[model samples]
Target: MIPQSALAIVALFASLVLLVMGNSSLGTIAALRLEIEGYEPGAIGIVLALTSLGFVLGSLFGIRIVQRVGHIRAFAVFAGIAAVAALSHPLHVSIPGWMLFRLVLGFCIAGLMLVTESWINSHATPQSRGSLLATYMVLFFLAASSGQFIVALGDPGMYGLFVIAAIFIILSLVPISLTRSTPPQMKRGKRLAFSVLWARSELGLGGAAVSGVVLGAFGIVGPVYGYEMGLTVEEIAVFMGISILAAMVVQWPMGYLSDYLPRRLVIVCVTGAAVGMALFTAAFGQRSSMHLYGGVALFYALAACIYPLSLALTHDMLAKHQIVPASSLLLLANGLGAVAGPAIGGAAITLLGPSGLFLFLAAALGLLLLLALHSFASERAPLVREQSHCVGIAPVSTAVIIDLDPRQESG
Candidate 1:
């Protein structure tokens, strides 16, 4: 038989693949269906923002829940709620109803992810940490990107798609729910101290929030952008899927490169590219051209890399105990951006029309790009000194990213 840790990793990866597939599919389906039902952009955006709110709340409160119950139990609870929540989408068609459903799923998913990450933390050895993190990143993006294509498999107008999503969620519970292994006890971090994080890594914290805006809007609103631009549902699915895949394709190379180069310069260069692509997207979004999708893919590839780079930088600056606090601060920044992105994206959609979504994103990323460049000039020596010896981290999210930090091995 495979070693227990190896089995756990495989199970978690497979389960996460199913969960993310269902989750990603649910988001696009909700967006497209809500639009088709004649919901306004502002209302749609609010519903989307509510999910981030729930996720933020979950991250804040979920540690205790995981501690009271073991990780597997927590996983089962969250998965059950999420599965039920997925099925509820088709049953209730009101804006408020969907918002509540999304909120619940978001909260559950956050806790679910925490449980998974803690489990992963225990399973990973120092020798395998870096490769494990990279694998996690790849699996996460691949599942999410592939899940977008699942939206194309069925009509969003009907119940079949929602049922399919629910099925995937339920199937995800199979492996771990049946396993006999003990779930890791939830590890508690030090109290969150945002002021310290900001003092130490302003660029990292600020960039994390900005990446949230960029990533949150793209993930939640990209399909809406495509729909309003007159793409067929299938075409929109492919557009979202392909764009995410482009990010997946680019991330390993970007991480490897950031290892050797200055993260700030890499961030600026990547964000600069994303800014150009966003401008391209804004200019050409409404047109029926394949080139627009190409622009989006490239834009997202660069855009997606920014957060991890910022995370790597943040990890380098903080001491061992300080790392978790910083991670919490980064998540707080991420949550703020996630909440802001949809509302801004929606307002832009309302005021400037569909292309306005990308326009707003361009503006957000543009500001962050400038911040990164300014940091290059103003905060050069510390980063330069640190870059020579800093360890890399792919902070996965606000709640559980530090587990993957290479520094954790020695700390």
Candidate 2:
């Protein structure tokens, strides 16, 4: 039987799953549509990069809207805007118009996540927080992965998929609007400056930024790469979906390993593995779908571990009270990297073709591996007691989600 605490947040979780599914499908569909419309790789990259820019902006400021209007009302407002953004894409097919719409989608999606995560965190007790967070992460990844298959439902060039996406976005407001839970009281927390955070853990900050670059680039360009390589929309859906699912597959083992080993060492190993997979994909991904899919899956499986490992590494060096602010700063770094990723990725694709995507990933992961090795050599390793247990966290999250981490100390 579900605990009362778990049952209490069922409405929020339902809304979260719906929101992610709709937003994820919209992103994949947008990229595929641009490729089909014959947009240049650079142009497509810029358009997609704008979405990340909006996300960064929202992460910085969207919380104020929530604090002002309250959670449920804020959720409804964000959802309404997101639904409009989804429909806007098909209605206005110009690059500028689509860019505007994608930006709005990103901002609103970030806002929605902020409200949902903060609400859930507020209601969580120390006893229930761990299980609730574990459930939340599972649902988040599953919805995102499954949402990719929605692209297979209709032509990317048509209105059907966009309309369906809009419907999903609008429908997400239902549970939240009906929920009886009162809004959580918002509190202002002191933020750790990036310069200070970097001083404490350069490897952590660097790893997070690079992880965002990798994830952001792949999210925007992976579908286009598949489309360019002669994949059917359905095949592209399967390829991307499996790659995302593969990210979740490796998290637990990676997190467990980091708990025992030096996190920098684990990071170096994972980064090294990701680099190898990236090279494999670049070399053979175009020739065989099996190689392409398998290589991409392994690449993400290893690459996605970097953020969580970096977070754990940072936690090792900070006081327990500092965890929340440090996480926000790290996420800010990740957001900045995400803003740059698509442009870098698009430039590579323009020069090297579809396989260039993996090459860029290889280069980024290679840089991160070198940094991890350097940090491992320079810094004294933390004792086991000083280290925090690793938790699998998504880089796209708002800082409020950090409160749900079991590593956080009770007030």
Candidate 3:
């Protein structure tokens, strides 16, 4: 019999392909919308903002849908919707049509992501949970990074972007369709326990909240920021690609470091570094396109690991049973933060200029860092003894790793 871990690895890999396709396709469109459709920056911001909003809504509903229909069916349904929506981008040709499509696309992606993450979380045992989650995170980061690189393959004007996206999204569907492993049975769907979860471990709650905001900013405004800075579509894509790459490369180290160090300390340092980088980049202002790419890459790399580092820390603080509630709380925090991050970032760019993007992000990170430090200081409990043998985490299950609460349930 094939091992569950191997199946999970396959599922996560598949999800990565879809992630690249979905995110990259959107990235390319964002970069090209101004030139191709002649939309104003504000309109562009609205489209991106709506998409983030759709994702937040999707996460809430996806859990219920998956509960009823099962993971595999839900995956196919959403993936198919995403594929069709992506293809339809070329058909609309109008800005309003495109906006509607983007919102649909956003909603569809949320379903796909939630279903995938839930599947993974359901199957993983505490013994191997860390490794499993870490591996899945690594693949996710890599795919997200590579999606941006797809822009370099061809012009956004041609059908190439849509086709590329379709290919990735379609490919993402395969492993789950073929796998024989049964997805874990859902008990009740995850619900927000915000106050309790936050009170239990401020670091975990704060981490989820900050990550959502950071992701929203990066997803919604990252491309737009590059466009405003005079980067060509190709360069903008490459710049985003580089940022994701930095995140991908840094994840494993961050994960292992979390295992060995105090998680709150690690989070503080990462958040502080992110704040510093954003401030420096905003102040420095890229002289040339190349400079922007390099700076953005560095900034992304520094900031991207915050989520995983926070995840590791959350796990460290809680008892085994507490993980589920903690994970659910984190997801809620992330959704709320994600919604706020982009709109605020976009408004900053509109009001203050492109550098305002970084300025806004820096402010957000500054708050996160302060919270992390404060959380650490207030907790006076003795550190748990380091276990000689850490838990062995399996690969992510396609059913639940992408979009649901990171853990399906608490106790």
Candidate that would win on TM-score: 2
Q: What is the TM-score of each candidate against the true structure?
A: 0.95, 0.97, 0.84
Which stretches in model 1 have alpha-carbon errors above 4 Å? Answer: 383-385, 388-398
Top candidate on lDDT is 2
Model 3 lDDT vs. the true structure?
Answer: 0.68
Which whole-number lDDT from 0 to 100 does residue 110 have in model 3?
79
lDDT of all the models against the reference?
Answer: 0.80, 0.88, 0.68
Number of backbone collisions per candidate: 0, 0, 23
Candidate no. 1 TM-score: 0.95
Tens digit per residue, CA lDDT, model 2, 25-87: 988899989988899777788898888888888877898998898888888899999898899
Per-candidate Cα RMSD to the true structure, in Å, reads 2.0, 1.4, 4.1
Candidate 1 lDDT over 1-411, as tens digits, reads: 788778878888788788878888888998888888888776788788877877888888887888997777788898899889988888889988998998998888788777777777777778987777778878888888888888888888888888888888878888767655677766667775788788888889989999888888888888888888888988988899988888888877887788777878888888888899999988875564666788888988888888778877887777777776777778778887887888788778878888899889999998998888888889843445455233333323446756776766655
For model 2, what is the error of residue 350's alpha carbon versus the real structure, in angstroms, after optimal superposition?
A: 1.1
Compared with the true structure, model 3 gives a TM-score of 0.84
